[model samples]
Target: MFQQKSYQTQVSGTLYLVPTPIGNLDDMTLRSCKLLKECDLIASEDTRNTQKLLNHIDSQVPQMSLHEHNYRERVPQLIKLLKDGKTIAQVSDAGMPSISDPGHELVVACIQEQIPVVAVPGPTAGLTALIASGLTPQPHYFYGFLPRKKKKQVEELQKLADQVATLIFYESPYRVAATLEAMRMVFGGERQVVICRELTKIHEEYIRGSIDELCEYLQETVLKGECCLLVAGKLEEEPILAEYSLEDGLEMIATRVAAGTKATKAIKEVAKETGLSRQELYSAYHQEE
Candidate 1:
């Protein structure tokens, strides 16, 4: 005689990191709509903002607020629900959640609690700006925003002044003019720059020229909408070998070491700046010391 066996099944809840449209409603992915409709609950940066989106897709799934103001407090509660075996979908006002927006804190908490999180990728303003800028794409750095303080912003620009890759930065309408002026000073007036404004919206516009030229052009226009600033990399210059003695290299190495640069990095930077081989410079530096 055989007895029937009863198996206890464990339900594991999931957290879906959903991406909303950066601008146009057409940018929303079909998968995103399906996920939003099917999830047990949708956690939104703004329930009101998400309501319209849900209305568009004819979804009425339960929605809750999870934004910058309340994310810290709400994450724990959301995690507990997940623990209780309810699937949760997280969405920002626009674009990917927790990018330069909401959801990071909650996502990190979910990770710590071993909750499953999946990304439903879609529209992104940063990327859209980069691609449409028509600059070299492979090697570009995305700077989400410039420092509010002029001095700090200048310092950041100086650090990347010599970078050979294109640079992308986001700016607000109010600061767009000043940001471009700062970029012109650090990167020089001759460098090509593209200013994308109100991307994916009806008022979308692209202002392309040298930094100085663009600044002049923008001065006459009333800037409106979101901004993405793209600047070309510094022109590649041939390495100029400075007249550096072995003693000088050793002294430079000591200074860099004091500034917390590793011996290997100091050697490479010194070689690049002074135009010398790593092995030859290392050997000569040792000989002089």
Candidate 2:
């Protein structure tokens, strides 16, 4: 049986997951602005950064830091405050909370503890760039950041090489060139790629070309601002590979698990694509002991 929580009745002691603008301040919605002002306390990823936003919106709401380091200590405190009937607004440094940012842990705890967690959708770098990317927008896969290690990053990309949907990734401006080189190596030099930088800000720019062309351009041009990389999906001439192997499914699950996806979820996704029995795949995958 499916369980449901009626969020409409969630008025008090609520956890509001608010999204701040990614780059431009004007993109901040009126509703989010009002909610932040009225929420009892603001749980900010970076209190200083969020303070600047509060300043921009003319809000004087009190804030407490809830970032990567302190979230473990803070989640329980926030839950207690929520139970005591204090509404809170959670904001990341930019864009949405918990999407390539902190707050996932807190959200999980809230759901487990029966606290209302309402997400206030506003902006995200991935979807913002994807819409204008000119690639296959639908069925896109959003992989926030690639693995930092060279070998692991290659392995992760190689595992996703066969995906037919446009691939969206978030990258730092400093590392984007190296990331492009990695893409060139894995997805080939001819794959189409678009990099949206300083999104919605004054100096916003979209650098678009084949992987090789962009790599050559970045050599001469210095890219600034946070970046979103959108790459066209693999174009397989054949609809299906006749020789699809079970080993391929296993590797996919392994990579997903290594990337922090739960084993059962990884198995379920891979199983759907591979037409393997869910129970059998789960057994085979968990048998790694």
Candidate 3:
């Protein structure tokens, strides 16, 4: 394992993962501003977009594009610059670099070459919307954009169907409605969901309701801007066999089965939660049915 004492003495130039504001420029941190002005070079996902931020901060630190298309050529060059003691700051058009954006490959390259990568925390749409979405804050899972294709998206979401932590996902405005409908089909219609639109901007809006309700609401409203969708996960449950009879495990399995879970899967899950034998729980559940 490689140890990184980030702030301690080191020779190679540091790779700062700087987070740009998701929307409103006022959200940009002072520390991030200082680094942008001080760093030797800025590696941006979009030089044009990042230029706006540099102009706002009144610093013209030279920038080179390191986006998805040119990363193969850029990483080695940036690594060499860092090796020669050139402090580099990397930024995406919006939000954290390499998060549902470009920069991961270059960061991996830096890590392998033993270059220090320091993340300067700032605005990230996922966590920004999550905290305001009126859902469980701790034990949250942030799954950034899902697959664009409908079938693949549904399959991917179904894999997370059994998770109990609050789920976070990013979606484009044109496809948010479709994604919500897909979520409704896989997670059930009554699952609580919150969709934040145009976060941090003047038109920022939060629509909080069940999957079914928001799906209906979006039908009439033509939404605009980037969307952050927060879906409440399946509730966690554990049955206490001490207060109940052994047969109660069968009832628990049936409850899950009725909720669209396969009998075998439900029986196995409930047996583990209730401290009952899987074979016994399976046999009892089917016999009762």
Measured by lDDT, the strongest candidate is 3
lDDT of each: 0.85, 0.88, 0.92
lDDT of 1 at 81: 92
- What ranges in model 1 sit over 4 Å off? 1-11, 238-289
RMSD (Å) of each candidate, 1 decimal = 11.4, 14.6, 6.7
The estimated TM-scores of all candidates read 0.77, 0.80, 0.83
Segments in model 3 whose C-alpha atoms lie over 4 Å from true places: 238-289
Per-residue error for 191 in candidate 1, Å, reads: 1.5
Residue 124 displacement (Å), model 2? 0.9
Q: What global local distance difference test value does model 2 have?
A: 0.88
* Per-residue lDDT of candidate 2, residues 7-91 (tens digit): 6665348888999999889999989999999999999999999999999999999999998999889999998999888999999
Question: Candidate 2: deviation at residue 167, Å?
Answer: 0.5
The CA lDDT at 36 in model 1 is 92
Model 3 lDDT, full chain set: 0.92
List the candidate numbers ranked by lDDT, top first: 3, 2, 1
lDDT of 1 by residue, 1-289 (tens): 3221212232558888899887899888989999999999999999999999999999989998998899778988899999998989999998888878878998788778767777877888888888888888879888788898899999999998998889988889889888888888898899999989888999998889898998898789879888888889887877675688666777888799889998778888888787767798778766755
Clashes of 3: 0
> lDDT score of model 1?
0.85
